[model samples]
Target: MDAKETLSGLPWWVKWIAIPVIALVVFGGLITAVIGFIVGLLFKVLVFAALVGGVIFLVRRFTSASSSSRGDW
Candidate 1:
């Protein structure tokens, strides 16, 4: 049988609701996954930045103190 004949066997509501509902579910899943990946990447970037800043701070403190001690001699 043709597509129309096959679909016509089902109730009209099934045809209308089933197609749209399935489409929404598939599209929604894809949207959710993309959003999740973006948020996770942002989190990783922020953490890496914080670690780099902390290392710079410690190095600056140690070097300044060593320099001042030598200058006093």
Candidate 2:
């Protein structure tokens, strides 16, 4: 009949443990791929942000040094 009725007849381990284990066994590869992709994308984004920040820092440092040398500061 319904899921509750079907699961209720089963043991606790079957309902909680076995079903989840079986589902993971069936879809483990897909789940792992999705997680790996997300992690890789996040890592790439962090690297890009760091590079942009470094460029900005270098530009500001050089501009300040050059302006101070010319008696502007």
Candidate 3:
């Protein structure tokens, strides 16, 4: 039987509310762990980008200042 036909007799709450609640209860820890891991990964990536950018900025500023003082380019 098609899924639509099978679920047609069920109430709306069972399809929307109850099913989602049951799924969350069953997989809440897994879901929480996945989200936490994603957040942590994004935070680490942001930190890495900031540090790299700072290093590049400082290097360019110092290099340009020294080169300009030397009268080259």
- Model 3 Cα lDDT, one tens digit per residue, 23-67: 999999999999999999999999999999999999999999999
Among all candidates shown, the one with the greatest lDDT: 3
Query: Better model by TM-score, 1 or 3?
Result: 3
Q: Which ten residues in a row have the lowest lDDT in candidate 1?
A: 64-73
lDDT per residue (tens digit) for residues 6-72 in model 1: 9989998889998888887979888888999999999999999999999999999998999898996
Give the alpha carbon lDDT tens digit for every residue of 2-49 in model 2.
989999899999988999999999999999999999999999999999
Ranking by TM-score: 2, 3, 1
User: What lDDT is reached at residue 10 by model 3?
Assistant: 97
Q: Each model's RMSD to truth, in Å?
A: 6.7, 1.5, 1.5
Q: Which one wins on TM-score?
A: 2
Question: Considering summed lDDT, which 10 consecutive residues are worst modelled in model 3?
Answer: 64-73
Structure candidate 2, residue pairs in collision = none
C-alpha TM-score for every candidate: 0.60, 0.89, 0.87
